[model samples]
Target: MQVVGNALVALVAALHLYFLVLEMFLWTRPYGLKTFGNTAARARDSAVLAANQGLYNGFLAAGLVWGLAHPAPVFASQLKVFFLLCVIAAGLYGAATVSRKILLVQAAPAALALLVIWLG
Candidate 1:
């Protein structure tokens, strides 16, 4: 169970890292525009904002990675909890304001991992 929880954590971290790249580096690209359902013009106009959002995603990924790599077990768990909560919060907000898919894509995994961690 602990191993499962940790793997889930890693999965979440990887997702955020992918998000970071998509938003920061590909916001205006064809793939990014298609992924976000954005018009080319709209993507160009919002590119900077998307990049900024991507940077924050990178921070979240970094935090999760830090939590995973921490030397102390208890502290590591705390760190993971904090960052997972942050991810959940962000996902909820995105679901409300942006798209419901955010809840499924972003929050659900973290929630599952949190549950696994708690049980483990």
Candidate 2:
């Protein structure tokens, strides 16, 4: 069970890292624009904002990894919940304000992580 929890946490961390790249570096490129549905100019204009958001995601990833590594008091599970909540909130806001697919791609993984950690 512990191993399963840690594995899920690790996967979440990696996913967030990929998110960091996609948002911060690739937002204007084919991959990011295809995923985010934005023009090149618009993506470039939003680069700074995406970097900021990506930074937060990176912090969340780091927290998950740290929590898994140190396992003092089920910190991984707790942080996973917290991080997923943040993603869920962002996804909701994005869906309401920006895009719906964000909810599917971003929130879904968080939801999956939450489920795995809780159920496994």
Candidate 3:
């Protein structure tokens, strides 16, 4: 049970790290072009916004990592579930309004994390 929750935490952290990379460093290149369907120049024009978005991803990762390291209290589990839900909701909203792939890429891991929190 503990192992499962820990794995979920790690998974969520990894996903957030990936989001950080996409939003921070790669938002103005071919990677972002492929991801966000924008030209290089357009992506470059929004670097500051991308960096801001990346910071949120980093925050999510940090929260999950902190909960993973200190699981003595049930608060950790609760927080993990809460943050995952937020991520999922955001992903779903983005997917519905912006892109369908966001739902798959972002919400799926969150759903898995929710499962771990529920059962573990």
Candidate 4:
């Protein structure tokens, strides 16, 4: 159960890293446009904003990674909970302001991982 929880946390971190890449490096590219459902002109115009969002995602990822690497078990769990909550909050906000899909795509996984962590 602990291993599963940890793996799920890692998966969430990886997802955030992918998001960082998409928003920071590819926001104006075809892949980013396709993923985001944005037109080329819109993507280009909003690239800076996307990059800023990506940086935040990267910070979340970094926090999760740090939690995973922490030496103290209790502190590690606390860190994980904190970061997961952050992800969930961001996801809910994005869903409300941007798209409903963000809730499922970003928040659901973190919620699952949080459940697992709590159970474990």
Model 4: pairs clashing at backbone N, Cα or C within 3 Å:
none
Please give the RMSD to the true structure for each candidate, in Å. Answer: 0.5, 2.2, 1.6, 0.6
List model 2 lDDT by residue over 1-120, tens digit each: 767766766776897898899888888889999987899899999999999988888987887777676656666567767776776777788788877787886677667777777887
What would the per-residue lDDT of candidate 3 be over residues 10-119, giving only the tens digit for each residue? Answer: 88789889889999988987877798889888888888998898999898888877777765668877778777887888788879998999888888888887887788
Model 2 poorest ten-residue lDDT run? 68-77
lDDT of 2 at 52: 92
lDDT of each: 0.95, 0.78, 0.83, 0.97
**Runs in model 1 lying further than 4 Å from the true structure:** none
Stretches of candidate 4 off by over 4 Å are: none
- Name the top lDDT candidate: 4
Clashes of each: 0, 0, 0, 0
What digit string (tens of lDDT, one per residue) describes model 1 on residues 1-120?
989999999999999999999999999999999999999999999999999999999999999999899999999999999999999999999999999999999999999988998898
Ranking by TM-score: 1, 4, 3, 2
TM-score of every candidate relative to the true structure? 0.99, 0.78, 0.87, 0.98
- For lDDT, candidate 2 versus 3, the one ahead is 3
Error of 1 at 43 (Å): 0.4
Error of 4 at 53 (Å): 0.2
Better of 3 and 4 by lDDT: 4
Name the weakest run of 10 consecutive residues (lDDT summed) in model 3: 64-73
lDDT string for model 4 (4-120, tens) is 999999999999999999999999999999999999999989999999999999999999999999999999999999999999999999999999999999999999999999999
Candidate 2: global Cα-lDDT? 0.78
